[model samples]
Target chain A: MLKNYFKIAIAVLKRRKFFTFISLFGISFTLTILMVLTAFIDKVAGDNYPDKKRDRLLYVNRIEQKGKDNMNSGTLSYYFLSHYTAMMKTPVKVAISSGFSGTNTYVNNKKIAVSYKYTNAEYWDVMDYDFTEGKPFNKQQVDNADRVVIISEDMKKQYFGDAGPVVGKYFEADNVSYRVIGVVKNVPVTSYMFFSDIYMPYTTSKADYKSKSYGGGYMGVLMAANKDDVPKMQAEYENLMKRVPVESKDFQHLYSHANTFFSSYVDTGNEGTSGVFIVVTAISIFVFIFMLLPTLNLVNINITRIMERSSEIGVRKAFGASSKTLVYQFIVENLILTLLGGIIGTILSVIVLAVINNADLIANLQLSINFTVLFIALLVCLVFGFLSGVYPAWRMSKLNVVTALKAQ
Target chain B: MIRLQNIEKVYRTDTIETLALNSVSLDVAKGEFLSIMGPSGCGKSTLLNIMGLLDVPSKGSIKIADKATENLNDKQLAQFRNKTLGFIFQSYHLINDLQVLDNVELPLLYRDTTAKERKMLATEALEKVGLANRVKHFPTQLSGGQRQRVAIARAIVGRPDIILADEPTGNLDSAMGNEIMDILINLNRNEGTTIVMVTHDENMAHKTHRLVRLFDGSQVQ
Candidate 1:
């Protein structure tokens, strides 16, 4: 019986080639755009920071007030780190780090601009950075290190040719010679911070600044304890701050992780581009709704076709086609049309996503469909098919045979 | 084998009430060939529709093959119709999108018959109508006479006990009309299939074994 229904559906669609084409085209086109947009968003969000130990890590930022100029920065001061480490009762390992600056290097007179950062020894233990060659700077090196540095793959390629070994090689930056102890893989663009070509010891930076305490300087900390203990640790750090030598007592603290930091920043409207994203999302939803109009038109066309075939329906009803059978046949026909449309739409969406991602007109953007995106598209097609078929199927099954046959 | 008792059908609008079938009652014996003849607006078609279980009677009961139709639900009535009765229409009413063979196979699609069986039955019915050569031709490609033959094939493919034809030859010329009558006569005589046809032509009415005429909403002589 099911096979018969499918055969009849195929015959009906083949008979009205133009109508079937239009309906399928409408549905597929809409689905493709929706899928691409959702995939792009998911890619940008970075899959919710998939590290299993994410909950144990804490990101620290500061809300500073200096002479009526208030700035909420994700980076904090190094002075607060020293104070928090000494005063906090919890045995949490704290790592303070800061973004790398673009430094011009003259290796054998071949000048190259490289991004580098200065951080304590604890920085290596807190974040996961893969090493391709050599080893990380140890506690002893960080304690006595004024000439040690880690070089990334790109930096190694630029300073030491492709075949040459970068480890144990000496490089000069700002007239300061430093030995590369380790070579790290180039950071992926998907990471929050893109600039980290080289990393230097915190002792080297501390000597340059000529201060045992860094005040009002760019810094960030990560807690190496369980996330559930964060609030308590944060409170203990706050109390520890009062006894430390600091210029301002009005510094505000915020606790977050790699996942929540970016999401919360977007949600709180802290990022300037949040409004743009919201507008884009709203427009995409509107486009999705507009796409549904074409599906509804197809439904209306189906209803008209069903009416024209009323006598056939009458005959079928007279021949023992129950209302359920009629309704099932109609629904199956529409679902087949929708599924076909969904496939076409998915293909089109992939092309669109590729085009958008490769256009290079949009800055720092990549769009592609993922598993989640495909699932959502399929779900949309199902909902659209069911909603569109309801009235038509009902009307088709409710047909009166006697009236129809009489007209014939 | 069919019986109608006090069948009434009323069509009501906002300001007027029209009676299409007024308390008409009749009986048809097994293997009977009956023709209903009436002028326009004479309720003959309405009576046929009511008898076919396509329309509910305003007041009355219908029995087919000795089973009461009043208690039968919509699904049961459809089952009864598909299993026990066949239909032929004046317009042929072949789905234009489908080929002649597919149109003929439609009635059997509701049954649990396999595809191969359905194809064989539909093919035999088409052959009986002398349309075997045009099985693959769509309705649009067929002549008016050919379309009606296909319709008849579709009606009989299910092997129903009774065939109800409403103006089966109305759209055909006299020659084509005669060809259709010949098929009906053959089916009745050879297969013992009861036939209830509605027509206005007296010549067509005379060919049937019994004739029931109607005027306005009531039956005459």
Candidate 2:
């Protein structure tokens, strides 16, 4: 029965070459758009932080007002740490880090400038950076730190030779002697922290700069103990905030203080730009519908073919051809066309994705036809085939043989 | 054998009801070669259709091979047709997309016959109709007479007990029509299969063993 269905379906398609081509093209076009967009979205949402235990890591931001205006700010300072360190009832470990915006020029007979981040001893443990040379800043170094910095591989190569061992070596920058404590790998382009080139101990920067509000800098906290304790820790921190003495009720009224943490720091604005995705989805639907239209055209064509064969139907009825048998044959023919179309469409989609990926317009995009997308494409084709074929098959099966044979 | 008692068929329209077969009764013995002849609107094809199980009568009891067909569902009626009847049509109805061999093999496809067996049987039928050399040729590639022969091969491929031909030679020239008639005659004489045909030409009607005539949806003689 299956062979018969396929045989008939192949015959029908061969007979109507134009229609078959149109149907296959439309379906493939739709599937390609859908698959490519889905691959891109998957890349954007979960690309960089695959190994990070993001659920246990929290980034703290202070939402506070300055003067008469309302402001939502992310930068925190050492003032927050001094207040929260004693007040917190939980064992949640916090790390304070500050990134300097200005570029520093290293004299290699020529000026090589790079941006740097100054962080405390906890920064290395929190970020989990694997150093290539030397060691991380020690707690004592952060508490009473002097001229020491960890430079990236790119910075070392620019200021020193490519094979030069920069660690334990001094380089003059910003009119100060800075010793390279370690050389680290270059940060990946996809990462959010792409600008920082050097790391300096936080205490050295604080003492030199005389900034008392270090707690209000960008603070990232890691709860390595367990995730289930987060709600309790957050509640305890909020409760501890109420106990801090306020200078005046009016001062308290002017500042609406709330603390919130992000588990992952993606530029939410960049991440939320799904306009391309929407356009892709809409085009996919349109192509699917366009493909279905051609199938409907095939149905109309089948009706005419069936009418042309009405006498044969009558003769078959006379010779004991069951309506069920007729229905089965028609369905088999439809399934065969659709299955062939599905194969062609899948091939076309792969080619289309490959071409688009090679265009280099979409950043870091990789489109591969995975099992999930293939299954979905085949399923869609089958459903479309079944739906398109049902009505015509039923109509052909119900044909009244005597009247059909007798008609002029 | 076939029996029909008080059969009536009325076709209803929005504003009119036309009777195609009315209070008709007939019997046909096994291995009989009978032809039904009538003018236009005379229900000759309608009677043939009822005998073929292609259409049901408005009021009648039909018995074919001692089985009552009045209560048979569409599926059972189709089974009955496949197992007990064969058909030849004026237009050939050879399924133009298929080769002559595949078209001939269609009837057996509905049966549980395996591919190898169906191919053998269809080849034998085509051979009988002198079309063995043309098995791979499509219907469109054949002449009108050759196409009819392919249709005949398809009908007999299942070895049905009855053969129903409606205007079987209407689309052919006289020479081709006579050739088809000769084939039908030889099959009837040699195989002892029951044959019922409907025709408008008097000369063709006279060639059959018995001729039944109808007018105004009723038998006149």
Candidate 3:
């Protein structure tokens, strides 16, 4: 019986190709745009690669010092983090690393611009960067201020022009020569916390980076045993800052909090307007608005289709079809249309995602719709089919048999 | 048997009211062949629709086979319509989307028949209608006369207690119209199936056992 209804639905849709095309275009286009947009957001704020332990980690990247007439705001000083955050009970390991700085130098008479980061040995354990060759320098090397650097796969290719045993070879950057101790995969550019062209020890630099008067230029990446301990670790770090005596008598108050990636983005310091909530609400509204017009258009098209088939409906009703059967039949027809649209949308999204990834449009913006995105698309399609299918089916079912049969 | 008592149907709009049927009492005995003749706007089709439960009379009591139907719920009405009544229309009203066999199988869908049983029953009905060779042909592929024959086949395929046809020959010429009349006569006489048809032609009206004439929403003869 349902098969017969489907046959009739297909024939009817074929009879009115223009309307079907319009509906399919609306449904597929809306779904594709939504999936692409979701992919982008996931790439930006979501965890990937070495940051896969994001849920189990917290970052202390900023500090604020307030006095009667002065206020200072910057990244927490290495001294502050080492002295206070190192003693944290909740964190299994507290790794400190410098933010990115430009290394503009000449190698083999070729000018290369590389982003460099300074790190201690614990930085390797806290983050999981995959090594292609050799290993990260040990704590002893960092303490001895040894001249060693870890370079990315692309860097090795650029310098040696081949995937090579260039590890033990020396390369000069910023007028300083260092042995290439390790080679790692070229990290995607969007991974701001870990991506870098070269990594060295903070002590290897000529300037003293650790013993600073004011807080800035360093981040304390704390690895907790479990994700649920993040809030407690943050509170304990905040409490530890209270006991640290001010080196300068002029400063009276200190403020800082360890934060996850999401909290850090939404941390307005006011605590009332959260960035995560706002972004989620905005995206929700965006998706709703995107789907609204298409859903309405599909509903109208379904109404028109049902209207054309009213005589058939009347005939069926006259032959003992109940309203339930009619409604089920129409809904099935609509579901078929919506699922077809979903398939088309998925195909289009794959092509679009592949193009974006291959074109290198956004540096390190490798995007794909995983299972979560597919599930979202399917849910959206189901909701879309229901929203667009029900009212028309209901109205068609409620129609009087006499009036329906009289319709052309 | 089918019975209607003092049936009154009124068409109401915001500003006016038109009486389509007024104080009309009707009875159709078992195995009876009845013809109702009326001019345009005389409520023949409206009365037929009411009798088939497709439309409700404003003030009337309907009883079919000793079951009072006016108070029956929608589901009950549908069940009764499916199990006890069948309909044939002026345009044949065969669903064009379905093939001849599928269209004939439509009534069975409302019953508890399985797919295999439905196919078997539908096949037998098509054979009875003399369209055994065209089981898979869509309605458009058939002639006007054949479409009406298919409509008759669908009506009787369910073994309905009664068949109500509204202008069964309204769209056909005399020859095709006579062929339809003959089918109805044969079904009534041989199978003992009650048939009530509405026609404008005097020749067709005379073929039935009893005749009714309506004018201005009332029975004149």
| TM-score for each candidate, following the candidate numbering | 0.82, 0.76, 0.91
Docking class of 1: medium
Model 1, residue A46: what's the lDDT? 54
DockQ, Cα level, model 3: 0.68
For the second chain, the TM-scores of the candidates in order are 0.98, 0.98, 0.98
Q: Candidates' DockQ values? A: 0.64, 0.61, 0.68
Which number leads on TM-score? Answer: 3
lDDT of 2 by residue, A1-408 (tens): 577567666876776677667665655665666566556544544443322444555555343433334333345565555456546656356665664545668565676777667776766775666578987788888777778998777777777767657788986667777888998876533343323567787766634434454235554453545667666666665565556444333234212122222223332222233334565567568756765676676677667655666765665555566777777777677777778777877777788778877885553355566667679768977887777778887897777776655552
Per-residue lDDT tens digits of candidate 1, residues B70-162? Answer: 888767777788888898878877777667887899888878788899999999999999999998898999889999999999999999999
Fraction of native A-B contacts kept, per candidate: 0.78, 0.76, 0.66
Q: Candidate 3: where are CA atoms >4 Å away?
A: A40-48, A64-74, A87-92, A102-113, A205-215, A225-231, A242-254, A265-272, A363-366
In order of listing, the candidates' clash counts read 6, 15, 0
Best by DockQ: 3
TM-score of candidate 2 chain A against the true chain A: 0.60
How does candidate 1 score on lDDT? 0.75
Better of 1 and 3 by lDDT: 3
lDDT (Cα, tens digit) per residue for candidate 3, span B35-125? 9998999999999999999999999898888888867877778888999999999988898888898899899999999889988988887
Off by over 4 Å in 2: A48-51, A58-221, A226-321, A365-367, A402-408
TM-score-sorted candidate list, best first:
3, 1, 2
lDDT string for model 3 (A1-408, tens) is 777778877887777889988988888898889889988877777755766688888877777777788777777666777778767799998788887778786766788888888887888888888898999998999989999999988788777777458899986788789899999987776666677889998788765676756585778788889989888887888788787666576778777778887767445543336657888888999988998999989999999888888888898899998998888888888888888888988898899999999999965568988668877787888888987889999999999999998886
Using lDDT, give the best candidate's number. 3
